[model samples]
Target chain A: MRIPVGTAVAAGSIVALAIVPPITEALREPFYLGLCLRLMILAIAAISLNLILGFGNMVSFGHAAYMGIGAYVVGIGAFHAVEDGIDWLANGFLHVPLAIAASSLAALVIGAISIRTRGVYFIMITLAFGQMLYFVGVGLEVYGADDGLSLYMRSDFGDVLDINDNTRFYYLVLALLLATLYGTKRLVASRFGLVIRGARSNERRLAAIGIPVYRYKLVAFTVAGAICGVAGVLLANRTDFVSPDMMHWTRSGDLIIMVVLGGMGTLFGPLYGAAVLVLVEEFLSGVTEHWQIVFGPLLVLVAVYARGGIAGALRALERRRG
Target chain B: MGEPILRLRGLTKRFGGLTATDSVTLDVVEGEVHAVIGPNGAGKTTLVGQISGEIRPDRGRILFAGQSITRGPVHARALLGIARSFQITSVFLDFTVAANVALAVQAHAGHSFRFWRDAASDDALIEPAAEYLGLVGLSDRTDDVAATLSHGERRQLEIAMALATAPRLLLLDEPTAGMGGDESARMIDLLRSFKGRFTILLVEHDMDAVFALADRITVLDSGRILVSGPPDDIRADPAVRQAYLGDGDT
Candidate 1:
């Protein structure tokens, strides 16, 4: 009946985070809530990437494309509603679900073609598709094109939930993060998860045993894309802006780095990774403008020394204690 | 016994100037251990590859369970009850022994689109996996990581995984290629236990195991079938003796 230490830590962190909104408000520094919101959004995005990269071994360098697509869906929906005075995009329930659906559809199309190729080719193809979408974003003349698009107001929940209140939004973000973490945990341990992990280990063997591995990998890729799309909805609400820069390949690389740093293949590793990477970026940028130069070496050191990332290190410590 | 479970017709594969499998043909009857034996260049592995649908023949039709599956994909062939064990051990090294077998069971059970329940504890997958592991004498090592097993044990584990798929026909490629004398004998006994229950296509370098297990033997030479008949006839054939079994041996 021993609980995995990583799971315990993740649960504890979520509890602490649930209290941070109130504590920060009491201290009159409500800005900290904003930072925590960033952490939650990034964690959701990273967790989605981890579903494929860590478990299925699909090294997609275009994951952020889904996030961008999701954000743009909300942006475009708002654009139609606010500018054109339409009710279709104005509906919260319809638009949010539609955004996720569109993202999953994009992943299915991209993954079908990309999953056929292996190794470096898969990475390059995903990156190429992501860049294609980024260019598309840049080319949207009606939506501010290269500059970006801004929402006049947060998504309308229509009495269901209020996105205007920072506290309510913070709680919504927290709830979604916990749900994603818990759902991903179940997903990676189920029958589907076993097949995906097996494909990563040995695709040929899995096929020999009667598993249609390509179809399974494609499903996983689509699911991950849909989850990241939901994160994008939160991200758009947080910043109230959508841009091609959101889908840039470097953003995908950042998501990959977070998965790698958190100890991939562990359910809670992405959250740990997102927090560390996002917080460190904030901390170092505050100290000096040339934060990347300082941060770059630290990432290399972790990549070199942290064999399995933070969660792996924690597991080792727990073993030593036992 | 009424009809052959597996039939290969005019199977041919050419690698540039060299012919790997040249217009070869064979039949494997139901519920019989059929052994394919050859020297290093006889294309035994290549033949296994073509039948398993990993390698497509330039000109041929593979009939499995009385259907032409020449163009069928590898996994489609597997779903039609053709299970193959690799010459090189290929079980999931990172998974536990039970998990390795459970994956095989899961593949055959139904669509593995299940994403909620914990598969590791599923009685449907676990019970059958344990049974298959027991068949290969690996029931006690269920919880052990597959990579930690000895080389011979891994080979046994590979066979266990293949068996877990519940295939009507088993394609074993050099099942005892790297095993100690004790391990080899144990493998032979385990395979022999399934003799009449499964139609097995075996590729082996070990003549003793082959002679002991094979109901029929096909001797391949230079990418062609030199001789194929009952084990006694194969043993007595002078062509087989010169081509494969050297004169000094028997």
Candidate 2:
């Protein structure tokens, strides 16, 4: 198979990650595992946003709301189960599906209204929905309110899987990331994907050609939300906590930044973006407490120099070689 | 004429006090190139918009294939065999020419909700896409990015995409608006090739193309019809000459 250099780079990175637990253990650096896990989960979220923002051209600024909703599903389910001693509600297997379904339903309602509007109106409405959800989270009296709720135990995956173990959990997240990438690649090359991408370029033209572009956009929005929500379940497991701040507007901005910085439309771009963002945050914090002061300029450089982001830059280089 | 295949009755649209299309009534036979011609701001574009469902008329009824479609959505009208090309050369600039046509084909072929297969390689989509591209004489430019094509080629690609939908009526809004002399001629030749095979409602500023291709002509002046008849009749009518063709200028 003739794999593009970028795809190879992405696969190699995943393979390198597969062996990370041993290397980090040898170096006595357990923090690397947590960082890698965070990167994978955030990558999932970025990919979900990419489906709408990059492909469908629906600039939703409230994507993090779904992630927060997904994480909250786990937190609320676990809390209620623990409080009332309900087995089915507490099951991790059930929790993941429930979280995805809840997030998908939320996306359907929000997308139905949000997709009706375009450009800045779309962005504003999405941000409004996000803020509404954020306030709702803060208003929950039983769920620890602003302080957030902690999971008493990590999700149980039966006797075969122990999510508490770092190596196993890392592999699980990695596998899901790979599957998401493959599935998304297929999706974007499918008929549905063409309509989504076509709408991005000329929505009016698409409508004239007998395609109901809005309905396709709604479906894409829902799918992205469902995917991101799955990532939220993983996030709650990784951090063992859920809070309203997770779905704040700034968090949504970060997801947008990830999509743009990595390469908005390319499949593997989000993974690179998530890795770069998390690594930069880690490195900057290590060097100086006020990392944003240094980091803000770096982002501006990427914005100015990389018109198509990193993936676009790589394609340009490939074109030059030929 | 056994109920014109397409009919517009009392179509009226107003932007505040300014009327864009005022009580416009028209009809199109099953297989004839019915041309709409007028000067700038004569509401040709607005009339096309109302027909295509982009601009909802304040008062009107549109019947396509003998069914009232005044409130039909743009896509629904398109699916009912009415395809329109944009006046300002709208297209998917980033896609390849073939891909642009393929997307149009995919839109009408079946449910676009299929998410698992690679549509780019599906022969069901690609085969007809190639056929349509060839029909527009864009077979050579199939792999070229649409944005890289010349202004004339982009317009041709637009027509090809419209044709891929297999529409019964094609609404072309100034398909040769920005073309040079040679490009405009080529477009005329292309449209002529489809004569009598597809119903066309053409809005144009090129008097030569309108006269050459239109079996019948409708003249619009300030959002109202001045005349609608055969091309020779339009040329002879002194009122049309003074208002639109400019008094013996033709």
Candidate 3:
């Protein structure tokens, strides 16, 4: 029996990511490890966004707000730990839960209002909420505000793990990414996932069939926000920095680009998108300063010609070969 | 006849200056095939919309099983055993026919927050979904995407979905709307087979279907009931013929 193209792609990527640490050490190039870590973290964010965007048909434009909220939780926790002598606040246990809860709360409020709207209206409402959070981050003078803040140190997990060791941190991030991918795969196939997909397909019919679509959508939005917050927490730890810019609208656009470029509805599409987009940006920037001039047209061409993005193109090729 | 399962009292809906449904009151008896027939723009769809909770009546009460559901949202009414099919054939076109019916069954099974087990493979949902599809004679087409089915098959799928809800009142909006002669006969036979097992409120422009299936017929003209009675009485009534049936176009 032959493996599906998607499975092969996912497996190949996972193996590549798993060996990156050793490969970097062998080649004496640590920069690629850092880049891969960042890619995986953003892939987590994209996956979270896809849960609502691709599955639930909610095109949220403010998803980065949750990531920013997660980053700030860590940044603020570390700030208090150093300046106010509140050391427990710096614990990873506190940081992760706090980030999840804070982002979930924000999502609940935002989703409560925004989920009622559809089409471009929903998009605008989410964008507005995101902008509001961005400005609030800018006004947070106690933290670094516009300039941003540096973490006092990596989150403390006691003797269980040391995130200061880049390899250990890389593995931890990879584990989270793998968990997210697996969890999302299960989620989309589960009853709740079917409800979300049903809503995406025909919300009226779902409601007519006795599914309270608004409640499900709100739950999905909150779940997505919470997961994205975790991604933000990992991002802050990886970079040792947190700022309003992390949750800026453009960052949210970048996440959408990743989802669209990979495959909107497929399980591993966002991972492919995140990897390809980052690599393309890195390679293009090296070639010229005006990289967006080349990138803009390329994105448009994908949008116009390849409606399913990279995953779709790969599936088409597989079908042809078969 | 059994006591009224659904009562619409003074139902009124206006779009801007146009009164779509005006102070219309009607009762749908339990286990009866109640047909609401009218000319174009005569408010049959609007009246159905009010009962199904898609449209809020400007002034009226919708009583289902002796409980007021005028202000209840669409899904709440659905849970209370009301299901409706659209005239334009609205369904989850991307999903399999079985999956579409399964989703309807899953809606009533419990809260769909089970986020682990694969829904596609669940025997609990798929079994009942297959039963409903078989009832509608769509057993063979269960695995096909809904969009791949013919128009009549989609209508059958729609009925299957509505039936899977185990609804107390099935609201069918022009189930034979665009059907050819053979397909329409099959739809009629399907509805004929469901005559007593399901309480249906049918909105139709097809005179033959209305006459053949309706135990009671309510004729609407200019957003108000022209008359309502047994099929023979509706057939004999001159006012209904002049207002709707005599148009010759139908």
Top candidate by TM-score: 3
Ranking by lDDT, best first?
3, 1, 2
Clashing pairs for model 2 are: none
Instruction: Report the number of backbone clashes for model 1.
Output: 0
| Per-model TM against the reference | 0.97, 0.97, 0.99
- Please give the range of 10 consecutive residues that has the lowest summed lDDT in model 2 chain B: B241-250
> How accurately is candidate 1 docked according to DockQ?
0.91
Q: What's the true lDDT of residue A211 in model 1? A: 91
Question: How good is the docking of model 1, by CAPRI class?
Answer: high
What TM-score would chain A of each candidate receive against the reference chain A?
Answer: 0.97, 0.97, 0.98
Each candidate's lDDT (Cα)?
0.91, 0.90, 0.94
Per-residue alpha-carbon lDDT of candidate 3 for residues B98-127, written as tens digits (9 for 90 to 100): 899999999999999999999999999999
Model 1: per-residue Cα lDDT over A97-160, one tens digit each: 9879999999999999999999999999999999999999999999999999998867788999
Give the C-alpha miss distance for residue A307 in model 3, angstroms. Answer: 1.0
Where model 2 places Cα greater than 4 Å from the true spot, the runs are A1-4, B1-3, B247-250
Question: In model 3, where do residues sit more than 4 Å from their true spots?
Answer: none
DockQ (CA atoms), all models:
0.91, 0.92, 0.94
